[model samples]
Target: MSAGTAFLGSAGVLLIVTLIKLWALRKNPNDPILRAVCGTLFIGALLFVTAAPPHLAKINNWFGTPNIAAPIVYCILTAFDAVNIVLLIHWRGNDDAARTRRQTRLCLTAYVAVMAAIVLLFTMGDAPVERLRDLDTYYANTPFIREMIVLYLAAHTVAAVTMTVLCWRWSRQVPGSLRLGLLTIAAGSSSAFLYDLLKYTAIVARWSGANLDWLSTHAAFSLAGVSALLVAAGFLIPPLGQGASSRWGMFQQFQRLKPLWLEIQSEIPRTCPKPMSWWRSMDLRLMQRERDIHDAVLRLGPYFDASTGKRVYAEALAEHAERRRARGEADASVIAGAVIAKATARPAVSPEDRWMLTSTEDPEDLVRMSDALARSPRVQAIRRWAALVGSRG
Candidate 1:
């Protein structure tokens, strides 16, 4: 691909990521990692746009100077390198906040010095002709221009190397999407380092009176877009994957509790939530359902009979059920018996019965009991017996 096409594609992807991070930033304004990531992506995008041949030429015409946009792009690129380093530092975590801040300040100072040198060299040198695509090779022998090109390239190389080493090591210590993301970043950063290595080779070839301009102009340019896209995906994966995982977990819990909730909801209408809006978040619906279930359990707790619950539990064990499953069946029969007794119980609830039900009020336990309520033949027999007892009353 042409340099313009590669650069433009990288810019577009970075811009989209930038907008997403910016929206996330509004919600978490004080998160250092988010802030640093946003800065890195935005600056990287800006660097690409400014370095595009057409945009660079327009910038030169606007300033009435030949190749003036080169220094401008170089400075922005240096800033991008600085922010990337800062982001990696932040990502390393705040185990020692003071040390992290010190490291970040030092990195910023060094990169800012590099940017100043790029500007100074541009002012001192003369590039009378515009060569947007081949500036590094064309100015390889020029005094100040050579130093300027070398400075930015050196700065970029250092950032890429540091990113690769740090991410590879960090990836091993982490698990799940974070691990995958860091490994991807390591790969992308190494590609960036290789791109610069080729650029260096091309410049040195020019110094030796040999032509290897394609190394800098073509090979490295192709790698640049792939590098940018990979790096963006690396940063994006963890958060997006974690968000998806959380939503799926909530959905599963909602489905698990749904049937049991519906079974009791009609009888205790006052404990139920009103018809919810279609647009409510899944978590909110889950919270509402959980609240209703807990409330219903407490309200129904008064009717529990300890003797009957113990007898049902003993019978379940005698039937050769696993202890865990037997416990669920016992709880299911107790709840079934309670449903019938709720209408007929006249005396105040004894503390023993309330505590018995309270001990089994765990949400996970409720889910198991609900499952048994729906599927257990043992619980179905108990339910029929309870119905007969209710009729006699």
Candidate 2:
């Protein structure tokens, strides 16, 4: 995608996520740390929107000043950085509640002062033409404008560097999803630092009578755009990505267990006396299927023969060992399949009296066992066991 498109897309995604988070926050309005985090994300989204090309001009016109969106964008970005610092402090949790609040207040107060300085400096500059996408480079040498650029850059540099250090240290301490998210955010912060340094250097070059406008106008802005996208992804991955991964896993388990559930369910109709309507979620369906399978196992308990289970398990293990598939994973499936096959053949004693010893909390073992039932050897062995049981009866 073009750079503008990428920026808009990233900003749009952040806005959508921020709105969702805000809606959730309505349920727990008293959560201070969570509110700070959402505030950081929300301000970052607005910064991106104001920095976008089309919105930049509209914002400038609304403010009735040429390139006026520049100060507004910087102010929002300053707010974003301040809130991010607050979030980091809260996440670190090394400071007491009062100390954390003091540190947050200090950071916010400093950024707000910087934001005011930026607006006052911009207003003092004499530029009348709008330079939406190139405001910094366009005013690189102007008196008040040059100082304004340096002021915003200095504030951004400090924030970015602080975040990089904090996030890197915290990443080493955290594990799993939190660690991953922190590292990603650190990378984004590092990118922001680079963008600020480049822009500052370019402005300084103009003061030294060197025309390095390309660095500030093109390269640094490009880096800033990339940093924005990365920061959005970093913020989103831990919560949204993990949730999506969980849902996807549940759907997969639901699909995988279906064949086995349907097979056993055919023989024990009362196990699932009623079917759920199609409109229900797959996650709910998976839960229902698991419950039905458990009920069916109980109904088939009288048919279960312990000796048959032992024999089938031993034979399957030996056969799979020869095929080099009887290691860690295959071993469990062999045992579960044999037990389930034996249960499918024995005569019913009392349906209400028996229960499977397997854990209902984890369905992985049950899924494996169901998968093994469809194997040709296991199916044939179950038939033989049923015939033997019939003859004995």
Candidate 3:
């Protein structure tokens, strides 16, 4: 097969892989910006494959030109990239304050102004028909076409450089997995810009009456295909890799906590000089708190699906209820207090909590109890139990 065909096939395979991975990891409620970025990259890859390969065909067929489809697809891809950059800035600013929002808007406006300038420079002296025909011709012999190609290359070079710098600066604040992915994306985009430069140089050479067969139309098409695949892969790999890493981290964390939990359970009998019933009650309360904290941490990652969160929460609630049933009121209040402490210590509630309490089941009673304790008028009441349970933290 031809180089262009091979590149396109590879790109298509990678695109499928990227999409599947994204689908699996896109359930992260905290990652709306990431989801949008991945979706745009996927769409951009599709457009690149659809519109970029046609310039290679020697035959003048319907598919060969790609017609208006090429420019439209390019515009869409460009818009997505621009928006992705703006979103990155907003995200880096932590989505806070009116000033940050204004900064994001201003950055986006500047990007648009630059794009408009590039377009104007590229189309300055050319008639629409002539420009369109020139675009269709794989190897044009016109000075204006060469200049336009150079201008396009320069614009892309600037964009790639800016992205590289931005990604570098942003990497320090992000997690390792995300940092790796962003750096990969910057590198891939830089490669694509270099490919554009090569193509522009070839066009310039041809305009100067030089026959550089190595920089063929097919070569440029293949380069584009490779670049698109790399870009898509760069954008897609991070979320999937991060999710996997988080799951492994959770498992390790659980293993580390296991011994501590066992020790806490074993120590209760020795520490409590009261009756067996009292020791059992305290043990149950500690277990309930441990379970809540564990569930909350597990739900923090992207691995858990929508149902997983609810399932975990329900299971914890059931375990608490079972303890209550077995030990009666002696353990019930202590267990409830422990649950409140653990839940409040969590960074944020998962989406599952919102759905479970509001839509799925009647969790309002338990929620109200927790809220009441949190906002109690008497700090001494909780403090009394706090000393009894030795739950200072």
What are the root-mean-square deviations of the candidates from the true structure over C-alphas? 3.1, 5.4, 16.1
What lDDT tens digits, residue by residue, belong to model 2 across residues 1-393?
755677677778788888888887899898875687688777877877778777888887887877888888888888888888887787678547888888878998999999999899988988787886677877887889878888888898998999899889888987767788788889999999999988877877877888788888788888887786666566666776668778889888887777567656654456355767767876788888888877766555555444444455567677765322222123333234334445545434344533333423457766665555556465455656555655575
Of the two candidates 1 and 3, the one with more favorable TM-score, higher being better, is 1
For candidate 2, the TM-score is 0.73
List the candidate numbers ranked by lDDT, top first.
1, 2, 3
- Misplaced by over 4 Å in model 1 are 1-10, 268-272, 275-279, 312-330, 340-355, 359-363, 374-381, 391-393
For candidate 3, write residues 1-393 as lDDT tens digits: 855466467657756765764765557645646655655566555554545444323222453432333344444445545655665565455546787668667766865665565455444434233122235234254345345445445555665676677777777778777788777777767766776666666666666777554564546555665565665666656767877886665444434434323322422333333333423544444445345433432332322123322343444356566432212222223333333444345333354533222211122233332332333323224335534544444
Clashing pairs in 2: 303-346
**Which regions of candidate 3 fall more than 4 Å away from where they truly are?**
1-32, 52-69, 94-151, 169-175, 216-220, 257-393
Q: Which regions of candidate 2 deviate over 4 angstroms?
A: 1-10, 20-41, 87-103, 120-134, 137-144, 169-180, 255-260, 267-280, 301-347, 350-358, 361-383
* Clash pairs, model 1 backbone: none
Best model number under TM-score: 1
Q: After superposition, how far is residue 168 of candidate 2 from its true place, in Å?
A: 4.0
lDDT score for residue 35 of model 3? 56
Candidate 1 lDDT over residue span 1-393, tens digit each? 766777888898889989999999999999999998889789878877887788899999999999999999889878987987898898888788999999999999999999999999999999998988889999999999999999999999998999999999999899988898898888889999999999999999999999999999889877876776677678778888888888888878778877667655644557366846758898998888887776766677777667667777788888976766678777777777777667555443586654265324576776777787888788788878877877786
Best lDDT goes to which candidate?
A: 1
